[model samples]
Target: MDYHNPNYATSLYHFIPSPLFLGKQIAPNAFQTTPKLHILDLSGNAGCLPEHPELSSMPELQELYLRRMQISVFPAEIMSLKQLRTLDLSQNSLQHIPQGVKDMTSLTQLDLSDNNISALPPELGMLEPSLQVLKLDGNPLRSIRRTILDRGTKAILKYLKERVAED
Candidate 1:
C-alpha cells in the first residue's frame, strides 16, 4: 500500500499486511499526513522500522499493533503518544523495555510477549495505577521470578513496584 496516497489522510485506522514492507525500512514521515489515525496495525510485516516512526502526529491514536514486525529495539517515538491506551509489540525481537516507557501515562494494556527481553525496567511500575493488563509471557525474563509472572498482572505490577521502591 502506498503510504503517500492522499486518500488515507483522514483515515482513523490503518493496517498493512506482511511482505508489504518486507526487509524495507518505513519512512519516518510515512504516516505524517494521517493525523486522525487512531489505530495502526502493521502486524506480520517483517521489516526494519525507523528509530522513531512518524506517529507523534497522530495524537488520537489509542491502539497500535506491531506484532511480528521483527523489531529488535523499542521504538522511542511511541512514548510520545499521550493518549495511547493499548500497545502490542508481541512476537518481535525486543531485548529490553526502555525507562522512557513511563512517559506513556495513558497506556492501559501492553503486550510484549514472545520477545527476547531478559529484564524489565522498574519504571514500568509507575503505570500500575492506569495499566490494567501487561503480557510478558514467552520471554526469557531473569529479573522476575516465574511465580510472580504466573500470579498475573497485579502480582507482576506489585513486584515491579517493590523493585522501584528499593531503588
Candidate 2:
C-alpha cells in the first residue's frame, strides 16, 4: 500500500494484515503519513510492532487493536494518546500493566486478556473515572482474587482503588 498517497492523507482507519509483513517489524514510516487515523487494527501480527511503536504520529487515534502481537512489555508510546478511548492489547505476552496507564485518561475500554499478567497496577484504579471495560480474563492474576475478577470491571476497579488507598 502506498501510504504517501494524498488519498490516504485524511484516512481515519487502516488495517494491516499479518500475512503482509510475515511477522517482520512494521516500518516506522508506515503510519507516519496518516495522522488522522481514529481506528487502526494491526492485530495478529506477532512481534510486528517495535517495543515502542511510533504511534505518537496519530494523535487522533481513538481505538487501537494490537491483539496477538506477542508483546511482552507495555508499549509506553501509547501513553501519549490522550484521545484514545479503546485499546486492545489482548492475546499478547504482557506480564504486567504499567503505572503509565493512568495517563490514558480517555480510555473507556482496555483489553488485556489471554496474557501472562500476574497483577494489576494500583494506578489502573485511577482510570476508573473513564475506563468502563477492563478485560483481565485468561490471565494468571494473583493480586486480585477470583471473586473480584468475576464481579466484572466495576468490582475490579473498586478493588484496585482500595489497594491504591492502602498504599
Per-candidate RMSD, Å: 2.6, 2.1
lDDT of 2 at 97: 84
Best by TM-score: 2
Per-model TM values vs. the true structure: 0.88, 0.90
Question: Candidate 1 on 1-167: residue-level lDDT in tens?
Answer: 56577775666465554665567777888777778777888787666567777888888899999899889989888999998999999999999899989879999999999999999998898888899999998999999999989998888888888888999
* Model 2, span 1-167: residue lDDT tens: 67667876667475556466766787776667778888888788776776666888898999999898778888888999988999999998999788989889999999999999998899899898689999988999998889889999999988888888999
User: What is the lDDT for 5 in model 2?
Assistant: 79
| Clash list (residue pairs), candidate 1 | none
